[model samples]
Target: MALEAGTVVVDAAVTQAEPSSPQARTERFAWGPVLCLWVLLTGWSLLRVPIPGVNEPHYLGKARHWWNPDWCPGDFFLDSSNPHLVYYATFGSLTQWLAFDQAAFAGRAIGLLIVALGWQRLSQSLTGRRWDGVLALPVFLTLHATGNFSGEWLVGGTESKVPAYGFLFWAIGNLLIGRLLPAGALAGLAVSFHPLVGLWGVIAGAIATAGVLLQRRRRHDLQPTETTYSLVNIAAAVGLGVLLALPGLIPALQTLEGGDPQLEHAATQLQVAERLSHHLDPMRFPKTAYWFAGSLLAIWLLLLRDFPNDSRQRWWRWFVLSAVFIAVVGIAIGFGPRPMAQMPGFGWRSSLLKFYPFRLGDLILPVAVSLAAVQAVMSWTQQPSASVSKKSLLTAGLVACVIGAISIPFPDQNPSRLSPREQEDWIAACHWLRDHTERTAQVYATDVGWAIKWFAERPEYVNYKDVPQDAKSLVEWNQRLWKIARWRIAVMADGQVTPEELADLKQQTGLYALLVGRFGPVKAKPAYANENYRVYVLP
Candidate 1:
């Protein structure tokens, strides 16, 4: 910060003197922070394999599907599927240019860069003196580095949310900078990739825009042209997002009741419909509710402690208010959603934020913690006459360290990837299936995971994790899928499969039931056996 007219003016992260030349503007673009972001995230995902049934295999499979439609699950579900096509299409293009695995890894690395750069922009736009923008790298890396156990961002690998958040950060950053049109466009892009954050962004953009207009009006500087321009910008921004999402949404509408036989009986529709359901059993709220509540409280206090002190700060203040309102609603939805309070198909629209309300905790944590962490760093580095320094800063730092440390359950440095304990067994089973099974052979696993589909190139009977979208077909799909899953579990518990069970299993999986976990020696024919699992080849 520099003294300007007897008031401290923020320098927007760069500490050195101003650059005179136009080229300096481009040269000043900070690459170091982006490098750090890449290194940290790339290092974390290095151990991750891009094979099917690994690290959000369903989503990965979808992305890979676009690259090679002839792959597992094939072009059969192509028309009826309601996956995040925008996200997949982007990465799918990458796969066409690069090796599949490299493309996936590159996507993750680039996604982190987008987020890091967006945070820099956001910090510069918001409390410029607070974070200095540069601090966003460490703050973000630390949050992710705390490991997926403390939290995981939607999936362990490069899932849709990564890029969604990348766009979302930019949207908020633009909003803070009073670039409403771009903000709206980015917000729409975010939603197109990942609907949750993008919807929140719409609220954020509206709040920030309102705050700006109100301030201008109060100063007696409001112009009719300004209002017109603002409205036009808002429409264009939202219009851009809708255009991005049109492909995904349009298909969902067109084929809601029309498709092939498999499509008609498909589980994708059910998963989609379930996602649109807002009312839930309140009993499901307790554990997740507490997590969201705690995070909400943490962010609110951080914001309340420092109200607006400048134009940038004013932008943050309105954002903070919008954020708080969103959090409160999320908490309410998570904790005690009134089943009858909402209209029909609330979750399907933009407002019914109740779909997976608890995950909102994970969504907000990075934003809140990143802002708070960077601001704290700024306090420590600034002049001795800083408002809060030395002891205050030290205490806060220690507290953060303790909170972070306690969150990680293990002694080994927070392994963002899965440990050997979990991954090794999964690897063995998936590899065995890949090498032994025919491409045409379908298998039945307890729960589809990792890259099982990718490596095995065989569809499982019911992939619970691979939730899809639907209208009337959703109920039937869930019922049928769960029935098969339950039957598989029951047969697993029985150890020796009944003649009847064997017959049904044979029909569902063609001839093999690839079951995992402990089971006693079976009297029935066992095709293969390992320490942790067994393959039942139905005769």
Candidate 2:
């Protein structure tokens, strides 16, 4: 006999039967533990000292500029370049609110919060349990701990890739809940912050949209209202995101109008695949591949086997596919001919630059960590029998937990942290520039511009190879300057200019002050000397 919705069917002889109550249908949200875990993870990521690579000093400097009321646009050390203004504005506002050191903790805090929230949301969507987010704790620690010594500008800071990752995860969470509009909006916001992150968003969004379509097809009786609402919401969210990003858009437009010469050269230079290969270290290949594969495997196990029938499974499949695409693209670049030339948009051959726009492979680690956690949860929920040995599984989980805990403390040395003495000298130089120099002075220094900007009381000029300048003229000017300078400060490991080259540089372009380290060879008498640095005023 069929049981009716409101009526309960019981055995005829049974004298008593318990009725199901409304309370049984209510869902419980576990907020307390999740919030605690978030707080703990955030604190751990923030308490560490800033590592040297990835332009930490540069970002700190930008934060200082944003925090200062006296500073205006165009005062940054680099020639007129516009960062995603919304992030800067938010950081600036938060610094004011907290009354903290804008360079040190205040700016990083915002990134930390965003990362934590995004991880929490992603975990919720993947595992349908809050505890599963614990797996992502290792990922958060790894990203926060890994310092960028590669001398690339985009690799570093709270404003760099970190926020983009946060936005990506947030979009994924919204997509999991059938919230396409909000997902699109999050993706739009991410693009405004970092245009490259749009690739991840597009991949994730496509998968989500496909999932919705598949679900509708599977359930033929489903109404169109849900689909229509989702589409409309996505459009609205994107529209609102655009409005939010207007400040960045306007400045970018103004910058493009002026036209940077270096940007043009960068576009041309990056076209060679050989240049791109130089940036990637062979040693990192194994680790990168491991993480990528692990994440994919975890996602597959969780969504395909455990949650095969779940509505959100299709989106998970799409996420895995997107990750795979990123990995495959990276491999192709690693092996293919005119490899750099194949990259889209920038130029026919411009993808060889160290910081190629769409090298989505960098995201493999985080995605893997996220999926691992989700898989663990799925496994936990699907345990075959109560008698099955939980001891071994628990031990494995504990081991993973221990490994993650230890990994956070072990700093990788590839980027090489500066010695304490070097750090002091660097800080001293920044302070001197900060106290000295006028606000409007276009102070040019090689190699130290990013750090100098971070420590400067005002903006000063530091030339970056990638800022987009006129290719023909700027390249010639840079070559001439390289001959005179005798020392290269722009890209680390590119090798110092030879003495003969310096003489040629002096003959070509009037060489001015040279900021050399304590150990840097000094041929001529320096105008000023300190324990850590010597300022050689060109004759």
**lDDT of candidates 1 onward, in order:** 0.52, 0.47
TM-scores for candidates 1 onward, in order: 0.72, 0.69
Candidate 1 per-residue C-alpha lDDT over 1-539 given as tens digits, one digit per residue, 9 for 90 to 100: 00010011111211121234221233233566556545544554443323321444566666767667655553223223655777777766676676546666677777766776666566655554322554444454445445321133522366777777777777666654445556656666777776655555555545554664466467654332212233444456556667765654454354355556554533332332244332222333346544544664576567447543444555455555555565556545433333423434433332334333333345555556666666655655565765655657655764564345334443223221445555566566766776887765566665324455655666665454454555344444466476776766787685655656777767754545555554434456556665555666665
lDDT of 1 at 475: 49
lDDT of 2 at 494: 45
Q: How far does residue 419 in candidate 2 sit from its true spot (Å)?
A: 1.3
Q: In candidate 2, what are the lDDT values of residues 73-169, reduced to their tens digit?
A: 3442323344555666655455455432444455555665565666666666655666566655644345434422121222124565567667767
Q: Residue 143 in model 2: shift from native, Å?
A: 8.7
Candidate 2: what lDDT? 0.47
